[model samples]
Target chain A: TLLENPEGLKMGGERRKITILTSDLRGFTALSERLPPEEVVKILNFYLGYMADTITAYQGTIDEFMGDGILVLFGAPTVREDDPRRAIACAIAMQQAMTPVNEKMEEWGLPLLEMGIGINTGEVVVGNIGSEKRTKYGIVGSQVNLTYRIEGYTIGGQILVSETTLQAAGDEIKINGQKEVSPKGVKKPITIYDIGGIGGEYNLFLETNEEEFVVLPEPLP
Target chain B: TLLENPEGLKMGGERRKITILTSDLRGFTALSERLPPEEVVKILNFYLGYMADTITAYQGTIDEFMGDGILVLFGAPTVREDDPRRAIACAIAMQQAMTPVNEKMEEWGLPLLEMGIGINTGEVVVGNIGSEKRTKYGIVGSQVNLTYRIEGYTIGGQILVSETTLQAAGDEIKINGQKEVSPKGVKKPITIYDIGGIGGEYNLFLETNEEEFVVLPEPLP
Candidate 1:
């Protein structure tokens, strides 16, 4: 009965534009197996609950929560001119907010948690998808898929942004050009960068479709 | 094991003031009874999913989803100077957004859903609450209780704001004030108002608190 409704997949003719952000906990599966299920759930709720609040603070919509992972949608359901910037800004805020939250967890004798985030922005179908009875508002496109793949490559506690995101953000943030490497599925290596300075001289690189490489001030421990 | 947590009940400690909004679907039981159980669940997911998005868009935390009802918390997990105002604005947005959503439902040949929203603001303890094994973050206090009680008094498609909420909104909205009426377990008649303008001088007077009256313009027969 739910699938009978055509509205189930219709996008209301709204443009398919959105930002996809994928975040996952580092070593979550291993930790969950080692810890009691109840404790694991409690800790996850406490932390994800916090992350969800921060993302929402900037008009981001949580697309879904999959156990140890979360998908956030920005610039969908509502459009904002600063959606890309807001998505990246939210990534930074999430990183900063986790510090105090981890401290509280440590004080409670719980293991500190780490996260990896990947953000991508592009035009994609945005609307209801499901049976006539149950419909989920979501974004679907290659960008969404690439975001998850990008998240898979992150080494935890780091945020990876796609070239499209960089283009949208323009000069608001500084980047340390990273090496170009081929990501899985994609035919060619995509250029990737590490954000270095906040504001100063043009540490900019030529816009080219090259393999991706990362330049961190210090190697990730 | 998810049941026991040392956190216990998070009674007022986090923020000095916060806003609580409780929304319940009218005639949900009867509506569900008319449909297949699986279809019922699907319909509910679609409606509630949209509501959740709107709430989160304004930085509100969805505490729980009970059947056709939802309890939302604002100003906890994330603190802002104007959480009360945010709650009020969110409620209004929910009401306005529902029109188009319901129209989409009609287009899909699904029954239109109606809900009542209640908003209140005051100091409350906000944190993790439960046994040692499992804990959930939520707000607790008399203000929280009053917020729920106010929800009970709301009718379909109507938003009821407490005197506390009114104080926060100032002259930004026009509300039709009603006499203070005592609710169950509470001794005082809490001053409440119909959120949007009903019509004429005021929306219909309940005459008796238990009676419901529609305030919208006359509909074509």
Candidate 2:
């Protein structure tokens, strides 16, 4: 039944500052090409499964999943002062959740997986979009693109966050390193920070002293 | 509040024969680059909104929407003998739906939109994926890849159906033209049919004598 006056959807959009999160498995695409499709999907299910719960726990709204990649929004349907912090916490938690996922994969004779998460905080047009009859929470901005670019820079098991997110997330986030890159479509060089952990109330950290994953990826355009 | 025994959750995947549909807008990506991202999303909402409702009305399970593209399943979580027929009818309905969507775009002073739909049928692994805590129905197979390849052959305003889908849908489907292309990764060249309409119970047809849209797209890989 279609409602003539769909109460939830308005034609226009609202501009608001929000945190964007994009995560993808490193080397998984090539790995998927080698394995059977079912096996590939099985690995993805386990990885995306744990990540979904972790993101929901931190109040992040999952926007969509493109194959093995996931895009999450921190403040679209609703806003929170700690949206950026929560996103950071969620990324850290997601990284930690990988241990159990990998363990399970090992038991099943599947390859261990590693994920890279990127976060950016910026103003975007956000709203209940996708026509009047459906409630598809949609957001769009250059920040969304930048988040994907930043994720592209990450190696396996790494979290690369934009400086804007760093500003919003505050000083609790522990940065191990930083890099400047001029991502495609961006005019100027921007700095992105590699984060190891966050402190204060939601204290969390990426596993330390782990062998570094150095697989460089072709940056996403 | 995680349920250890999620009633509908099954760890294993099920193999099933199903129909797959993928559709996308042509040249929209290049056109969108010139507009603001918010405007891009606004245009997408109207386009995807109608498509969503149309697909739902036909009992198609929307797998996901990647930007302006949508992947739908006709027989997953459940199946029917006439799934291929339903997919054909749904594709015809989706192509015809572009009329109203474009009209709204014109009223809003936005550029008109055109869509191409493709359908294919084959066996695949389908199941309630993600995790026991969440019911994310997922599918993966060579058929899924082949369906994408078939959709990649479509031009805007065209409906392309795979030979497999044609055979499954029976003779009620109307084929306007056919082409044999060896899409990348496929071992042998497969024939795809350009459909004009479907006969029988759910009668649907594309408008006759419409100006041919001549823009050729670089096939999706």
Give the top-scoring candidate (DockQ): 2
- The 10 consecutive residues of candidate 1 chain A with the worst lDDT sum are A200-209
Chain B TM-scores per candidate, in order, are 0.79, 0.87
Model 2 agreement with the true structure over A1-221: per-residue lDDT tens digits: 22333322435566788999999888775576567656766676767778888888999998876657788999877888899999999999999999988887887788889899999998776655564444566665567778888999999889999998998897678999999999976889999999999999998988777546666799999
TM-score of each: 0.46, 0.70
Residue B141 local lDDT, model 1: 53
Q: Please, what are the lDDT tens digits per residue for candidate 1 over residues B1-23?
A: 22233244232234347788999
Residue pairs that clash (backbone atoms under 3 angstroms), model 2? none
